[model samples]
Target: MREGSPGWARLALLALLGSILVPLVAAGLRSVLWALVGIAGLALAAVGVWWTLAHTGVVRAFGVALTVTAPVAVLALYATFGMLWPALLSLALWVLALTAARTASTRGRTASGQAVAEAPHAPWVLMNPRSGGGKVGRFHLVEKARAAGCRVVLLDGSQDVTELARRAVAEGADLLAVAGGDGTQALVAEVAAHHDLPFVVIPVGTRNHFALDLGLDRDDPTAALQALSDAVELRVDLGYAADRVFVNNASFGAYASVVADPAYRDAKAQTVLKALPGLLTDEDAPRLRLRAARTSAEGLQALLVSNNPYGRAVDAGHPGRRERLDSGQLGVVCVRVDNAAQAARLVRGPRSPGLIRLSAEEVVVEADTATLPVGIDGEHAALPTPVVCRSAPAALRVRVPRRRPGTRRRPGTSRASGAAADWPRVTRLALGPLLRQRHQARAGASGSDSGSGSGSGSGSER
Candidate 1:
C-alpha cells in the first residue's frame, strides 16, 4: 500500500495498536496461580543463594535444599500451566512490541548536527589484526581500506598506539582512522583532535559501543570504510580520566577489579561470577570513594562514568542506548549494596533503591589503595588515587559515511506523514487515534471555533 493513502494509514494505526496491546494481553492471559508460583520459585532461589553466601551452618543447609527445590517448582508450574505455547507466544509478542516501538520512535528523531566537509585526500588507518577474533583478517579490512585510498598500518605488538597516531598526523596525514576496539579508537581520536583532523571509525572489535552510537553499520566493517569517501563530520564530546581519553566509558570498583585479573580474557563469565560475590560482600572498606556536586558515597560496589548518559529506564526501545553523544555531561551510575539481601532484591526487580544516578561535568574519586585499577573503554590500567574525571565538550570531529544505517531524519523538515521509525515511538503512535477522536469530539461541540480546532487537530492526526 502507498504510504500516504488512507488505507495505509489506517493499517499502520491498527498494527501499531496491536503491537502495543498484544504483550500486555498475553501477560494478562497467563494463569495468575502459575505466575505467583513462578515468583515464589524465584524468591526461593535467590534466598538460597544468599544463605549459601552467608554460610551460617543451618541456613546453608536449608539454602542448598531450597536451591535444589526451586527448579522443580518452576518446572511443575510450567507443566501445570501448559506453558509451551504461551511462552513462545509471549516471546513473539514482545518482539513485535519492540519492532513497533522502534519504528514509531525514529520518526520524530533527527540526525546529529554534523558539518559537511571534503573527504581527506590522504587518509591513514590503524588496524589491529587480533581485534574481534581477528576480524581484520576475516573481513579483509586492510585490503578494503587500501582500495578505498587509505594508508594502512597494522598494529603488531611492538609499537605504541598513541605515538603511532601522533607520527601519522605529523607525517601530513589529513585524516586518521582506527579499525579496532574503543581503546584504540580513543588513542587515535585523541591525536586527531589534537591535530584538528577528522577521525573515522571502522568497528572491527568486540562490542563497538562507540561505533553503534555513531549509527555506523557495526556488522559490516567494509561499509565503515565508505567514510573515507563520504565526509560527514559530527562534533562529539570526549571523556577523560586524568590524561587518558575514553570514547565510551571508564569503570571503577568491582568491574575494574574483574577486568584487572590476568586471566579475565580467557574466561570472562566465570571470572566475573567468582569475583563479584566477594567484591560486594567483603566487609573491608570499599577502596573507591566517590564525590560529586550532587552525590557523596563510600564503599560503592561499582561506578560507571560515560561520555554521555545512557537512558535511565531499561525498556525495549532504547535498551541502554545513549540518545545523543554531544551532551556536555558525564553519565554516572553507582551501585552500593551492603548485604546479599539487597543484591537479591535488585536482581528480582526493575531497579534497586540503592542505585545512585546522576549527570555531571566532573566527578572525583579517591581510592583507599595507593593505586586504583580502572577499566577504560574495556582496557584495564592502574591509576593513582584521587582520580579526577571530566567531560570535554565538542572535542572530537568524527567522520561518518554519508549514507549510513540508522540515520535519523533531519530537524525542521515536514513531519506530516511521519510514521514511527523506532519502537518507543510506536507506543506514542498507538495512542494517537484515541487522542484524535477526543479532539474531534471537542471540536464538534464547540461550533464557533470548529474550523480552527478541526484543522489544527487534523495536522497532528496525519
Candidate 2:
C-alpha cells in the first residue's frame, strides 16, 4: 500500500459489499477495518508534504517530489471518478478513505521542500504540441495558466521558438510555453535560458521522448498543468553543438542524412524502401572512422553522443536510469562493423556486440573524405566542420507531469535494430585502448551511436 501497489484488500471489501447477506456484526467489523485504512492513508498524506523523496531511499523514493500535493490530488481524482461511476468508490475510494481517516496524524521530514518566493520571478512552459499524437492544443492550457496568475503566450507554426522566448521576456512575460515537437521543445528551452526562467514542458506530439525522460505526463493535460503550480525547480545538464542547445541527443554518419531527407519522414514504407540496403549493403553509401568520447578513440564506422551514459545490457532506448536530467556530463556510444554477416550478428537484438558507451563533458567530431551529415535532435542543420560538442552550463528547466504507477514506457532501439540489416556497422576503422590503455575487444556491431542518448534528456548535439 505504501508503494501504491495493487493488493487484495480492496477485493475482500468488494466481496463483502456485493453480498448484503453478510450479518450486521460482520459488516460492522468491515467498517472498522476500512476506517483503519482511512487513517493510515491520511497519515501518509500529511507525511508527504514534509517527505522530500517519497518513492526512494529506505523504501526507495516511489514518487516524485511533487507528491507533496498528494492530499489534494487523491481527493480530486476520487471525486472526479465517483461522479462518473458509483462503483468507482467500491474500487478506488475505499482504499483512499481508509488511509485518510487512519493516518491523518503522522509527521514527516523534508527533502528541499521550500515555498516559492514572489520576487525575481521567472517561469517557462516548454510545450511539445506535436507530441503524444499532437493533441496539445485541445488541452485548453492557456486558460489554466491564467488561473495560476501567469501570462500566457502560445508558440506555433514555423516561428523561431528561441527568439520568440527572448521577446516574451522583453514583453515582461516571466513564463513561456511552446506547443510543439521535441525539436521545438529544445528551441524554447534555449530561450528560457536567456531569461533564466524555469521552463514547464507540455507534451503534445508523438512519442513525447523528452517528456518521458523527465518523468512527466505524456498524457493528462491537467496533471501536467498542475505540476507547474508549486514548481520546485531543479537544474539538469544541457548539451551544445556550436551555438545551439540540444536537450536530448546528437548523431552523425547516416542518421543525419536519413533524417535530413524530407521524403524519409513519417512514411515508414518509403523510409525503409530508401534507407535500407542503401546504407548497409550499398557500396556507394558514405562511411566514416568512429571515435567514442572519453574512451580510447577508434577509427570505427559511426559515432554518437548521448545526454547521459547508458547502462550495459540495456537496450539503446531503454537505458534504465535514476536521473535523466543530471546536468554535468554526456554519454557517447559507438559500434564498428565492415560487412553484412557482422551486421546480421548485431541484428539479433539484445546481444548486439562491440557496443561501447562512454561518459564525458565534451567531444570532437570530424570527417576525413567527406562532410558528415549531423542530426541535432530531430532537426537537420548544416554540417559544421570539425564539430565540437560539449555539455552546456546548468540545464534548461522544463515542467513535466510526475510519473504514474505501472506506466509502460517502451525501450528505444538502435538504428540497425530499428531498421534493416543492410547497414549494420558504421564503417571500417581501428579500435584503440582508452586513456588507461586497453586493447581491442572483438564482437559484432550495431547502431552504437544512433542517438539513443537523445531519449535521455539532452537533445542532439549535432
After TM-score superposition, the amount by which residue 446's alpha carbon in candidate 1 deviates from its true location, in angstroms, is 2.8
State TM-scores per candidate: 0.76, 0.57
Ten-residue segment with the worst summed lDDT in candidate 2?
A: 422-431
Number of backbone collisions per candidate: 16, 67
Please list the C-alpha lDDT of all candidates, in the order they appear: 0.73, 0.51
Best-fitting candidate, measured by TM-score? 1
What is the alpha-carbon lDDT of model 1 when measured against the actual structure? 0.73
Cα RMSD of all models vs. native, in order, equals 7.6, 24.6
**Local error of candidate 2 at residue 217 (angstroms):** 1.6
Model 1 residue 33 CA deviation (Å) reads: 5.5
Output the lDDT of residue 404, model 2.
32
Which numbered prediction scores highest in lDDT against the true structure? 1
lDDT of 1 by residue, 148-221 (tens): 88999999968999999988888989999999989999989999888888899999988887887777788898
